[model samples]
Target: MTVAVGAPFRTVRELWPIAWPVILSGLVALFINGNDAFLLVGSSDKVLASAVAASAVQFVAAMVVTGLVGSSQVLISRAIGSGRRDRAARRADAGLWLGMWGGTGAGVLLVFAGPVLLWLLSGPAIDGDFARAYLTVTVAALPFVGLGSALRARLAGLAQARGLLFASIAAAAVDVAVAVVLNHMIGPFGVAIGTVAGSIANALVLAWFAVRRLPAPTGVRAPRATAVFGVSRGDLRDLLALGWPEAILYGASSGAAVVVAWLLSDGPAADLAASRILELTTSSIAWIVLTGIGTAATTLLGRSLGGGDLPAFRRILRHTLIVTLSVAAGIVVLGLLLYIPILGLFAPSSVREASVPVVWLAFAQVPLMALHVPVTAAVRAMKDTRTPMIASLIAEYAVFLPLGWVLTRVIVLGLTGVFIAHVVFWVVSVLIVGIRLIGRIRTPHTLV
Candidate 1:
């Protein structure tokens, strides 16, 4: 369990024992999410636009929640790595407290912000109403989704991949069942509701396990939430240090995509649909490498560094990079090979032609984007989130959005241009993260 800084085991060899299960779980989760998205806008361009619009508000809520929830993973991973079981237990309790308040706050904010956000994202007349309805229902579920995030992060940091996987599979099945049934019955709104129900269910499952399996408080001690975990200045600082940047990066990325979507709103329906589908697929693959393996890397790296195993940490980093690169290449190949069929799943025949080109373009960029996960995760493992945040802002705001707007709106390359913009964005982000990681590697001291 105690690995040196330069542990001989390859990162893949080490990480696979933990990461593959997480990835499998993530795929199931991503598929459910993507399916819900597809259900909302499979046929109508306007509905698709609305779905994106609604998702914008949800994204903001997620960022805010993540700012709080993210702390749990870093702290818990450190505790676990150092074999501080009690501390890990305490942190898990803290995560629950954070989830309740943070999720509630985010939910309230979303309920109020939903209308304002929708209005801001409004395009043509038809799309506005659909967007409003979808956004409303989804945003209504903010508390559940936000809490779910906190729970998931805690479990992940504990290396409870199996539990997480089970929860995800259960959630996905329920969500899908509900979505299919409701989509037939109540239309797009039903799908959104079903998705929310799934999130709620997922949170419950995670909470149940965390409460039951973690160490119990002695009779002399107070309740877990009241006695063990409370918001503290230190906790806030630690959480904010890593979490804010991640939240900001995610918010910016999602926001940028929405902006680009708006820019090309007037393009052909097929093209727009294709762009959405591409985004969905890209997001799916991203979770597999970035979010999935990244979660594992973050936990492993955080733990190793916490235990003063700098060499082991570095080994983990190396292995993560190797695995990420392999996965990225795999995504590219899979993307290219499955282009027509994958796009077909989300688009009708009428839009298939235009969708194909945009999707292919998006697939071409998967490898670059894939490379970004390990670097970001590794840096986060070092508990230095500011660097990644600064890098993301520069890459996304300074480079990606501007170029996307130009290519898609001004230059009018339509979906294809949008795809190119995404590629450029990922390529730039990967480089930025890579450079930062190298700096960390060269530093004399190990960061925990």
Candidate 2:
């Protein structure tokens, strides 16, 4: 994929070049993640629950790790769009620095605070030996999670999709191989070990590309390994300015999800496992597909705004919406078609019956799930991170949490109630950001 040189995307096909790699990369990682269910075939309900729960927590925490990647996306894309290659490289270095520090800090917290957080979020139901064992081993992946994500954001800004895809493939290979070997000997903890090994492999390769293999946009001298930690104060401020809102929003969202889990945990654990299965399975697929479109939107939007072309930015938004809606329909249809197989793969017999409808119910979220990614990307692309953050806060605290509490607690619907609340959350959250997005995308071709 070529970085935009102040020119707007001229056709829909242009997006495929930027979109496919990240989508493929996410799928590779997720496949290994989903394989956990396959690997533990004869496991008990609690073992199955612990496997999914610990993994879910790890995944959410990882998203929080990379959530601020928008900083690099906005900064380097703008610099590249403006033909300021040296500036783009410097901004990327700052992002790398931030990622390392943030990820390291997060890891420490997961180790020290994770148990407490677990107790608070899930109570007695989930505070068992297997879950704790999985988390303790998997926590080592924290730094790699951050470091790899930062390197990826930098590559994305430079439009180096192939590099990103290759790194993901490498990580997936190591993760799967390690998990397969270890699982035969150690069971559930093998998945945890695989995550750490794969993360380290992923980080190493991405670092190789960032420092040596990938060519920086010419104005900077080739970046050195040590340059990542040499970020200036100004660069830090710039990253934080565009990054914090989305970061905080993700953090809040993860917390909100855990509370929903707590509600489900209060009931039968099969119900909880069913909920987690739907989330890690269908929800993950939806996010990966939609996020491909969002990443494309971010790239196109950042370039158009950086080059001061308002009409082009709006055009990109229009194209993004068209693509998202079309893809959303396919996701729903595919989810319907695969419903039986998915339940077979991830749900134990205990969870299987409950999950039958939960799988169908999840499709209620596909449309809005698809829509929100690009809409939020559009808003964030204009560097208006705070508005989306505010919009999300309202969507969650004001609507999602209340609705979920009613459906699961007051109404006593259990797993089904949680899914219903999820559907409504996406609906409300999408609307708030979408209304704001409509106004911004209509302005003349320029940065908001």
Candidate 3:
């Protein structure tokens, strides 16, 4: 199903069919991260604090794994777009291999390093022991999570995202059921166990679909076969070159959030809880939409680039920006109208009250995020990750963190200040990427 990017309205209509399934899949993925907090919502403040802290730490690790394998989607999409089914299959296999081995190494390192890291990050308020316990269970399942990412990427790159939707639904069902059973059987630890179980289920289901979709390996073998598991040395190098920037980008962004949470740990308990609630809610909505749009952009732009269709690429980019910005505007309006009730659903009255202003502040940045997310994905689809990574570094480290520190700590602006700093980060990121994208568009012939 090749996309017709010539007509803007037709392109958008075509986009929705592809985007909705990926969006649903992203939502289900969020369930894996959010169910813990959802189940623990009305628990004691201490337990809620512990769960939030542990979850945040766990999220950073998960992002690292996902980022490391993210290039599979871009490479597979480009390969398929260029009509190289064999190469696409090989790249998929390489991603799976990397996920399995990389996950093992990461899990092992986390087992040893998690405690101290959690201790340092959790500060005096949060329960370090509980955080460490959660990390142990979830980290052990990193391989499964990593494998799931690779499979999902392969399917998405092939424009077979419906498979991911089914996998996500099944996995979410398992996650909720396991979380309930474990929560009753043990305690907060059940949430972590449930998360691991769900991740494994998700990976297994997606793997089944991915295997069926990918091409079978040819029997031909070179005189000296250097490839392992259908992936050559050059494949590994390409994956790394394309993937590391993404890893660093995800790590930096997540790390900044963790730092903000830690800084808030010294404040009131309500402040910390509210911050967590706000983060989860906003991220769930924003990321779901962003990921969906990004996937579409990646697939469409990748195919255009692969086919050397510069005009089509430009058309798709323009249409994507329009659709994504419209979506962002809608999210902003909906968030403003519904944030209070939504906050009430996940947080106690005290926490909700404390979080209202922060939620409003976050909503203000959605437009900038809407612009940044799809643009970044478009840039990545061109197989140029370094640009987005550099933009992220400057936005997070150079602008966001220092500003957040001064506002939250030095000037004592608190949560409000932290959120404002976040808005500033997005603004700068959008400017940098937007300018680069404009420059590329003007010279579309040179993009390839």
**Best-fitting candidate, measured by TM-score?**
3
TM-scores of all models?
0.90, 0.92, 0.93
Cα-based lDDT at residue 154, candidate 2: 82
Per-residue CA lDDT of model 3 for 3-122, tens digit only, reads 444477877876776788899988888876788878887787667777787777767777787888887889988887788877777777777877777777778888888788778877
Structure candidate 2, residue pairs in collision: 309-445, 310-444, 310-445, 310-446, 311-445
Residue 40 accuracy (lDDT) in model 1: 63
- Candidate numbers, best lDDT first, in rank order: 3, 2, 1
In angstroms, how far off is 310's CA in candidate 2?
1.0
Ranking by TM-score: 3, 2, 1
lDDT of 1 by residue, 332-384 (tens): 77767877876666467856776665666666676675678878878887777
Off by over 4 Å in 3: 1-6, 213-230
lDDT of 2 by residue, 64-169 (tens): 7777754687788878778898788788888778778888888888888777656655544464567767878888887888888888888777777667788889
Sequence-dependent TM-score of model 2: 0.92
Candidate number with greatest lDDT: 3
Weakest 10 consecutive residues of candidate 2 by summed lDDT: 1-10
